[model samples]
Target: MSDPQHSNGWRRFWHRGTWWKALLLVVGYWLVYQLIGLGTSALFHDVIDVADPLSSPASIFFGVALPILLSGLLLIVLAASLGWARGLFRRESLPGRRWMWLAVLLVLIPIVLRLIGTRWSAYAVATVLAILALGLCVGFAEELLTRGFVVNILRSGGYGERAVLVLSASYFAIMHAGNALQGQPLSTVLGTVVYTFGFGALMYLSLRVTGRLVWAILLHAATDPTTILATGGIDAHNAATAGTSGLIGVAGIFSFVYVAFALVAIFLVTNRTKVAPVAPATSD
Candidate 1:
């Protein structure tokens, strides 16, 4: 059982990644996801409520779950085609530290805050289950796309650790700007962009510190449902209005910390220890 990334199959044709390909894939993923959402919404519009997608099972299923799941399936297919399906799961893609525990803790704290604020008793079990399924899909899909593939691609392209950190997180965060096209208010859209940028860095840290992509996926998965359920809406538009109490008041604190961590981490991300992996050569 050798590393499949080095296999003679896909590697022969795939060659290697460039920085532009990373951007292209990110844009392509956004397009596919948005198209899927549009397609599903049109197909299920009569059955699914157009209002409050987070709280409604049918809406969440037809809108968020089905669209993202389909898009995620496409990503998986692409990963397999690129010979990355198996290699993407391997650990220690970047260096780690004990201090990174703070990074992990900051990331986890918001989930706790949101959990306390969730009125779990208010929603039907089906709705709650739908939200969970949505989270799982989101976690796997987003993490696999950004941290899994993009990070590897950046490294393979000979980018330094800092550039990889910045680009991957930026690609993950900036894609949220699409909310504006979806008709979100300027304030809400800006807020989401800011929040997701920080969230993206924290997710990157989650991958780095744990040296495993799974932790990033799980944290992202946990964060989405909790935020959705607690806020009674997605993407913090309702964050200010939805949910109350002590810890929830402390919400968005992690965003500041994550951004700060990213800022400071840039200076520290100078470790050039990883040997950039090239496309495996074939014998003539």
Candidate 2:
């Protein structure tokens, strides 16, 4: 017979549930993010004489890419160390419906066009590429930490699909609150919060429909650059200088459109007749 003490200990380690694990991941990611930001600022203070570190390729490399790369690497190490590799890297099939693919196309095609159309100086082109790289890292790190880690934990802890969806989405939205410190207006920040919450819900649905974290990561990486490009290219620095009312107006309109599409996608995915949960692998 198995030892009860050993069994309980194992359960405690693996079954810590959504709340605490999610909290820990959020706090940990924030700390890593902040530390990277501070360290990058110190390292590039002279190179990046301006207030914004995102204006040039060198600053973008150190300030955005380096930290995000480190954080992503750390998450990989932790995922392997904690025996979460299966959950973090699990794969699933796309949904059966054609509309889902249509929704994805709607979101993706325009963004790709905008990215291709955006004009940049030869030097600025390098910075734009760096920003795209940064977005890719952000997508991978954030998705792994949230949808891959937190969602799986919650699901394994016996949470239902709805509960899992809501919790994961809320956690993602809350995590973006740190953007406020970047000089975004309160109203614009709140608009982004709502927009991200809705976007998170769509991503949750995407995870359910597509059954792979890679799709989510790709979509997320694509989405970030789309936002930057749509709002007037990287050099605009809208968040830093756009006045409160103007920012609010722009954010509100953007959020409204995206949120509407997000809702429609969520509804389509969730209400499908043959939808089923894609359980994470049980092997450690």
Best by TM-score: 1
Worst 10 residues of 2 by lDDT: 272-281
Weakest lDDT window of 10 consecutive positions for candidate 1: 275-284
TM-score of each: 0.89, 0.77
TM-score of 1: 0.89
Off by over 4 Å in 2: 1-11, 93-99, 121-123, 230-254, 261-284
With a 3 Å backbone cut-off (N, CA, C), the pairs that clash in candidate 1 are none
After superposing candidate 1, which stretches have Cα over 4 Å from the reference? 1-15, 236-241, 276-284
lDDT values of the candidates? 0.77, 0.65
Clashes of each: 0, 1
> Which one wins on lDDT?
1
